[model samples]
Target: MSTEQNNIRFSRRNFLRTSALASGGMLVGFNLFTACKPEAKPAVDIANLNFNDFNAFIKIADNGYVTIFSPNPEIGQGVKTAMPMIIAEELDVEWDKVHVAQAKYNKKEYKRQVAGGSQSIRFGWDALRQTGATTKQMLINAAAAKWGVDANTCKASKGIITNANGDTLGYGEVVSEAAALEVPEDVTLKKPSEYTIIGKDALNVDLDNIVTGKPLFGLDYKADGMVYASVLRPPAFGQKLESFDDAETKKVNGVTDVIKFGDKVAVIGSNTWAAMKGKKALKAVWSDDQNLESTVDHNKELIKILDGKEFDTRREDGNVKKAFAEADKVLERTYDSPFLPHNCMEPMNFYANVTAEKIHLVGPIQTPQWTAGRVAQLLKRKEEEIDLEMTRMGGGFGRRLYGDFALEAAEISNLAKKPVKVVFSREDDMTDGIYRPAIKYRIAASIKDGKLTGYHLKEAAINSNMYDLIPNFFPAGCIPNYKVSTKSYKSDITTGAWRAPYTNFLAFAEQTFFDELAEELKKDPVELRLELLQNVKDSTDEKIEYSGERMENTIKLAAEKSNWKEQKEGVFKGFAAYYSHNTHVAEVAEIEMKDGLPVVKKITAAVDCGILINPTGAINQIQGGVLDGIGHAMYGDLSFENGKPSHKNFDTYRLIRMNETPQVDVHFVKNELSPTGLGEPGLPPAGGAVANAIYKALKNRLYKQPFIKELSSKKSEVLS
Candidate 1:
């Protein structure tokens, strides 16, 4: 493989559409790679041979190899492999002959290219399928013209086009002719039953590279004469730099220079070790510019907000006061989650070569377009002067969505006037990180005549609150009298999206609260949820975000698959179903008590995300999401002391170990509905399932996150 990487650029011309066709007309175009000069070929091996661009998505080489470009960033969500499979399926090409390449960011050529919210596949489905089908029809038209036959008589499959008389023409034979033909107005897409490539097991495109230790990730990227940088930022969130002394840093061997920008000092050196050593050697002073907050402060403030009358009512249906006043019984519970650092496997790093002429940025970033715009505004340069290339991320989990690291690299290079790659040590990544904000939720339910009649949810969070749509999700339309209120306590500590965002904890709180409500109503946990979903279906409200029918199916499937009602000697099961990212998922966790502690043994998940693409990848996503959810809910916690993180690395922190991981069995609901998002939906319900299972095994209710802590406290209380 070539170590020198090229800037990912696409054709600037818009896709061609004939005026004779209706709106959203068929797209036809020649090689976007050579759109400026059709006679010229790309400077590659295929340049000497015949090749053609099929609707700016696919390319066919004379050797019969097909290349499909995936436009979204690959954040270990399998969109890199799954998106191309959509194109390959409708293109009627064999999977083995197809090659997948990550496309460069070109807003004019692609839409919604960012990799967040697990929406890549959902948004790209129709356009991707249409691209492939249109290209195939154009090729068929070319073959039909060459053979003097009606296009209706031509059948294409496996890169081969056949006329009614059994005359076969390889796609490579007609790709050039297809390039000159007008795009067909309409093309038929194959039924799910007829799919050959989609809904089938396909290995990840980068699997070999990842396993064999190839340079496929941002950390592996390098350029000529690139210098390394290690930066020293404020130790605490509420502190700012007063002054810095870098005399000792300058004397360090291999250290080139030290530059101070904004509130940070960057040590530049010939290599990573020298830069890091220089950073440690430098002396700096910081002054507290604002209140130095701590976890205790956050805890007290969150609870205070929950108790305060000042609130933003997200949704309210009925008189909650009257319902609670006239109720037979009332139950209220509070759940809290601590700040969480993303802690991606690969620390934050980016390469930047900035000059007066242009700026080159190469790294793994989820929001490349947005980052590019931000960099342009920060550096006082035009957006057109920047070129960003995204590499496969080792792990994103919503961390890469922010471009602060990339911006730092660019600014440092601009100051030093040399190509620079800023590397963040594990300590920097953990301490100075954009974290998931600490949130507290209080849920109250009123029971009347042994039925759940009223529900009220209050949210208090740091910096921001949940998305407006969360209040409209499940249990919103189910309850006769429902209300959701939110309050936010602004903190200087930075926080952004973490995996499933609010639902990561919200689902746990809601699902567990439902379990408690079930007990109060003298009902089974699963049955209670089914009953609520039936209420939703019976309602005529069209504003609810979740589908009662789809949610019911997944819950039933999960319960059935896990033998929810069957009593096994040692197995205890807990069930939870949720809708998020436009996908409905239900999960059942099986656990048993060992040495007076609850140990999760297995997790069964039933997902209804419409259609399944690349079953192998889908299962991997589901299992990974489930495990991530379980690990974070049980062990993920970040504490603050004087606005500084308590733990800076894994040694001090905790994570779910390999031996602690449970077996995950994932099943999908059979449907032809267009695919939604699978990356995050599986995660929202996993925590609730596991927490409820632990309750079943221990017969104790745990309301907080990092459940191990609560469980230990419960054990200590019982002993006392």
Candidate 2:
């Protein structure tokens, strides 16, 4: 439950059922009794939010305020504001009168609560609007009935209903009348040109709250007697805990007790700092099992397995061997990207309080439904006994998807028998983390007379990362006569999604190779990409596969905006394009080599994430994600030595600070299609754009990440 400082439980729930909504529509209970209940069972009715409808309403009381419920968490995407706009616009109600609230977790109803893929707006766009329009029509019918006029002659506007006879009725006055009517089945939707709420720039609803430091994030979550806890895990990947000497840890200030659960030894304390201090004091030993090693040597051994192996084949076209054999020239380049950390601004932390019946969980999470079930299983209880509350994330980037932190917190609370907030220290969080898979890609392109005749991509990476989501990520048929396959070489290291997942490595390799091909063929890179993007758009199909059409669009836009040839001077221009996460993105990077360091001056980015929900927010995501990609490209690396990670904190692990951030210009391709993902699409090109620019400036190719210095043109030059 969201708490303000005043701590007043208003009539938000009670007014939902008994009052009319902004659309002048009454609540339709999935249950017959709740629908007809006389001002009772507000709680039950609140749970039955019709997500399939757009004008979902809880209340419009005599005060002329309408409360809108938003199911998707506002983790910087601004869904908390944009989603309610769908409701308000359809309801024809004043924006200020529409008081919004974070919806309680419900899977059977809210289809878009799974927030990882950047589908919040796409999922909620129609549902919320239809809900509002339906309810509004119903309210108009009720008002017309009360005025004794034809319903067709009645129109609703700004929470008021009027008939041709000049009889006007406010929604508040017609609440009792509207609640008694049967819901309208058919409703008229607003035309695109008629959209007053969507496609317009609106201030984020929580801007003031966020700026004021309201209790919006899980870290800011407070409760009575909330004790902080910290966990000590294995020293390295695949290693298990052998034992721990907790005597000195228990003597630390604010130490309450040391508890052991499975592999972790947690120190419960009064604050996060004390809990971390106590965790550091504990001397623990881990069993170095499974050749517990992370080194270039181990990766070399893994690369051997990748040489000729094959796992699941995503796409296979005309005989790849025959295509390569018939071609005049076939060039193959092997590319690699190392394991990376999520490094969300807020580290993993969750508050859990266990009682005899239920366990309450609060934190930043991508999939609450999945976490809720896992929490129940970890606590050895039913799903109903575990309640998960999701809050705004400081930064998710696919890290909060890990539910182990929540499980640990719940387990500690269950054993210690108190509310425990387990916050992982920066060192602990960095060293012990789920890294982006160490990926290797081999790209082979067959050229015939300055044209790419055939294309084949063979990739090898740790299968353990994104083990479940791989089937869904394989590229669609965008290239003909192409063969694509994957080989898995598992490391004991826990690998998971970071940004665009496999596409991060795939894009780097594919785009880089594609750029190289364009240069060798002496054809314009943008023009070559446009030729490959030729595909027939399907009219009857709902799901369209990739043909790089959107990618072509983005590249054209970026080139036009960035003035590809005439860059206004003082900038070395570089261009890169990538299609991932169902959206296509292209970037033109303006860079300057300053004292042997490549510094970005500006970037013109074009993205197509489908229809714009909040234009400003989508732009913000593209800008932020692009800057993040810039940092990782230039100087972000994580290495291990002697069974321990080399970098643990920001002082060691590098990030692009505010001063280093380039001027990012974000644009969305004008399209009237299904909303695609934006959370990670922009990230894939940041590296390639910078590399391409550097290549142009220095006449050399960059083969590695963290390119702080120029790579020697000599083939055998390398540094430790």
Candidate 3:
């Protein structure tokens, strides 16, 4: 509301625009209100909360319920549940009184909206607290103004402010009057000890809706006179659109339209089943121009190129060559991981209604604002002319970060000249998905007196789908005398961010190699890591280091919880740990080689993401991440031959089933900061931890991924 603040953040003319947006009572359903507001009494707020330039985050209804517009989304990672809890705690509102909604696009009010790289909480930490406090202060100010009392005499708690005499005013009473006032400046935040809702076990805000099967997902979105459509894409990556004769497809019943579009043919009908039926009727021809595409051969080429050349050095330490020369002995090995599909349960789908001037879209997307801009460009309109509604996603393991389906929907809508919903069939979703890039890594370690003296490592990845993350990682100074080089080979296969991006590869290669070095040095891996990590301080120091204290706590906790030192009856335990996204995690995998098969019996993990936002939710994410990593490392591979993917379905690209999910026990060490990202930080370690466990059980190193397969081979035997 300050003139200087306004001039800096917003244009003079938009002051009216901002005022109208806040007060116009535009009931057309911005979809920020759930598009399901009750017609009757809801105990709405008496005054609106001020957020400076930020959007109206705390919208209180007449019925004493508060709605918070969260910029990020809820794609089963439980943001809808966990994010609001932070506010409800800070704002001192009852859980039952809170109603959370996804925010519309507003560049000034929000940052970190795309929600990948586990940066949600890292960026939201300061901003969200400010969000909650700004709104709370405004409410308190409103109550104070209405009572003709000084603001300092009024205190806000549990959606109400009371004077010294204990006379209270509900938030609904003065919200309208407060909405007319200038938004407050200098809102103060609460002390950590005063937090009541945060750090507490706040159940998911959407739990009831999800459990009761309300319309909480994109697949459930429906409108009147909606038609279903199916896209006929190539069965493999290299295959392309050749001339297709639709004469055989026009005869099918229930088929309405045969629309020819770029790279695909659409079969449209009155119902999903009918569209699917018509799609099956089409007999189209595709050129095998890309028949030579193969992820396997790509992997081989990457390894060859990696061995021949050295690319950019991600990190370098003291005289690596000299250190290697002085070492007593040096050992080297090559490791590989295959391409993996996200295979979200819902598959990729989007609905769009396009016109000459405007477009309306709804779908499960990670970046709603970015999608809107791209859709506008694709539709040849201004970004503001487009209205996008974010729907709950079944899953988004970094697969949906690219809005391919949104673009597809825009194309379908523009062509159909009607509101169209483009749904990728399970088959199309499986084969066409951008998968985790397959990577090839070569590592060399020089050890002396069972103490690591030097290390030289390089990773050659299928660069076509990934870029280097070394600029933002811990390789610079986590340890002494370390050299890490990175090179990427572009591949024909579409690759993208899997769960942890390059961290998965980094963890497997570095941790496994560290284990090997520890064995040679005759030192416990945990103790050895402590020796290296203890000297490095914070990421801001000259030798950028992960917080050694946090890492030590996680390792110590995992060691104790797993009863690490005691020999188990039949299970072999191995430990691996890493820090990412401001969180520290250490894991110990208990394994049993049953029938020569690496059966992960259980896992014990310790994490310190700062103050636990939701203990159960954090634990759930760790367990799920561990299971997902196992699936990727074991039976999952997007094999290709003749320039086409070999595995297109779950039957071919197998996932780790419930039977394979180990008995996971997770513990979070209490710490100082708020919460950091919990969703993805756990994934990088499971693959490495499991690999180390396999190595412990089988002494001979299995340098390849899916170690279970190689170790469990018919003729192969365990090292022990």
Candidate 4:
């Protein structure tokens, strides 16, 4: 059960509305914001269901079938299902009778609707609960009034209300009367012990549509008179389009016209095949605008920055110089990781229809509001004139957060004066992607009299440094003498958020460094981390982002469940714990030697994110994060040559094969502190755990990404 501080609180002025549908149904919705009033407009019809302007999130039909609108974008993170589960639990409705729908973007109806940072549940927990509980209370009042009894004498469960006299009424029969009641200022939310839905396993609502080859994804969307377009963008970062010859492209069988905008050329046709074939036949000339950068150049530049004295100090505590000078021994290691592409299963695509009246955009977008604003600006129209709808995404992984492809679609449609859908072949998606930046970290720890005395860390990257909050994450408050600094070298290659962002690679580097520290001190790795956390638990600092007690509990649970100290014939295990995206996670990786190489066999993970919405969905997310981390650390690499990608397709690029995947076991710490992030925290500790396990199997340590290449070559030193 949640504590008093976490209870759902409401005001008498809360906006609650009820409307009688033209089809004889009732609508009930409660918006937390009291200032904004919904516009008086006609009800909209979707699939023959009437939904009013004020009841955007909930509608109860005459037959007792309920529709709940999910206000956030669905990027395969389970938010589309889990968010509605929260509402259904408090509304006391059967899960089978509920229907989930993806909501169109409406600024007045939703807040923080983007799907990134794994924060949908965390931010929506309170308001969603209030929405359902308030509606349920109104229904109870209506039932009690009908029976001439006190409201406390009525009990509501599973869309039915029963009075003390044993008279029962269905929610549909009393919904119209309930809608007329005043908004309840206080309603009790169910305790965790009484929950029948939130913590239980619930199947995805769209499972049937997904498995039956239905049109649910953005790639499956179509419209009347919509033409297909294939674009030819700059092949290299430092090059731009100087001229193009499209006479041959115009001769292709279904090609209609060719248009050029900025540094890209678009070919239009009746179908995708003709558009692509026309693009293949077109020829374009490019001219260099600056120096073409390569992977080798980036490596040299990062190393130079690390070796130089130019730096920006992010954090400092105590006297690191004094502690280092008085230490008995010092160990330093530099770890490197190459750039990575998102590599979404569905390549970049968006549909746009631009006219003098309105702009219609329909596709998979992580940031719908942001994309709507950008599309309006690019077309020089009002934001209110754009209608944006989000489709189910095959995969986002932060790629859809930037609407570059959506902008291209709108631009092409406006230039050609026809509704167009821009599609990118695998090559176009891979070469013109906002990739994860290449980074390197140099860490040094000083030991004095068998105790860790000081720590120093320096980072070098492309484009931007780590965000300001990361410098204060776990070890910052634990270490007495700690310091951190960073440097960056700008490049034309665009970089943005990818999965766990900075902590994804940072965790691997720091956890392995801690393992080396444990060896130097003759202590167990788990014991060393516990001792470090003890300091944080005793500290009085309030600015720290993670809780030491929660992280310690998570680590202990992972170790106990995985039998960290047990020894089997050829089973080697390694443990790692980290805090990121507002959640604490610990992982234990088990490996076995196969033909003189370490092969990961299984992974056990423990997480503490306060509350679990759906165990089935939560477990799937945890397992996916672990496997993604392991696969990327082992084989995911994107290299560059003269401002162009070295590999553009899966033939040259490698991903983890099915045979390489391992079984994952997950455990969650039961608590009621309110839910945090779940989609990303499980991933940060996975890479570090696997790396430590590999070192146990082999005596050598790895300092670079694509660990398979280093293992195959037997490279004992840094590869970059």
Q: How would you encode candidate 2's per-residue C-alpha lDDT over 36-104 as one tens digit per residue? A: 222321111111222221113445565456777766655676778877787778778878788888766
Per-residue lDDT tens digits of candidate 1, residues 1-720?
111111222232424432211322222432332332244321111101122222246666655578777767898999889988988898899999998888876655554457777777765666567667777888899899999999999999999999999999988787767766766645777777789988889889999999999998888998999999999999988788999899999999999999999999999999999999999999999995454653248999999999899999899998888899999999999999999999999999999999999999999998887788888999999988988898999788888888899999999999999999999999999998989999999999999999888999999999874447468898998888999999988887888778888889999999999998988788999999998888887667776878898899999999999989998988888889999888999999999888987788999999988888888988999999999999999999898888889899999799999999999999999988888888888898998999999888877887999999888888898899
Q: Rank the candidates by lDDT, best first.
A: 4, 1, 3, 2
TM-score of predicted model 3? 0.89
Each prediction's whole-model lDDT (CA):
0.83, 0.70, 0.70, 0.84
Collision count for each candidate, in order = 0, 12, 24, 0
Best by TM-score: 4
Candidate 1 displacement at residue 54 in angstroms:
17
Q: After superposition, how far is residue 584 of candidate 4 from its true place, in Å?
A: 1.2
- Residue 347 of model 2, lDDT score: 84
Which residue ranges in model 3 land beyond 4 Å of their true spot?
Answer: 1-56, 105-112, 290-296, 464-468, 471-476, 538-545, 713-720
lDDT score for residue 174 of model 3: 59
- Which tens-of-lDDT digit does each residue in 1-720 have in candidate 4? 454232455665444456677776667555633322223221111111122222237787767778888877888899989989988998899999999999898766664457777777766676677777777888889889988999989989999999998999888888878767777777788877777989999988888999999998888999999999999988888678999999999999999999999989999999999999999999999986555653248888999999999999988999988998999998999999999999999998999999999999999988887788888898899999998899999888888888899999999999999999999899988999988889999999899988888999999988764456368888988888999899988887878778888788999999989988888899989989988999898678876778888989999999999999998989988888999878899999999988877788999999998878999999999899999999999899887887898889999989998999999999999898778778778888988899999888887788889889878777444454
Candidate 1 clash pair list: none
RMSD of 4: 5.3
Of 1 and 2, the candidate ahead on lDDT is: 1
| TM-score of each candidate structure, all chains considered together | 0.92, 0.88, 0.89, 0.94
**What's every prediction's RMSD, in angstroms?**
8.2, 7.5, 7.3, 5.3
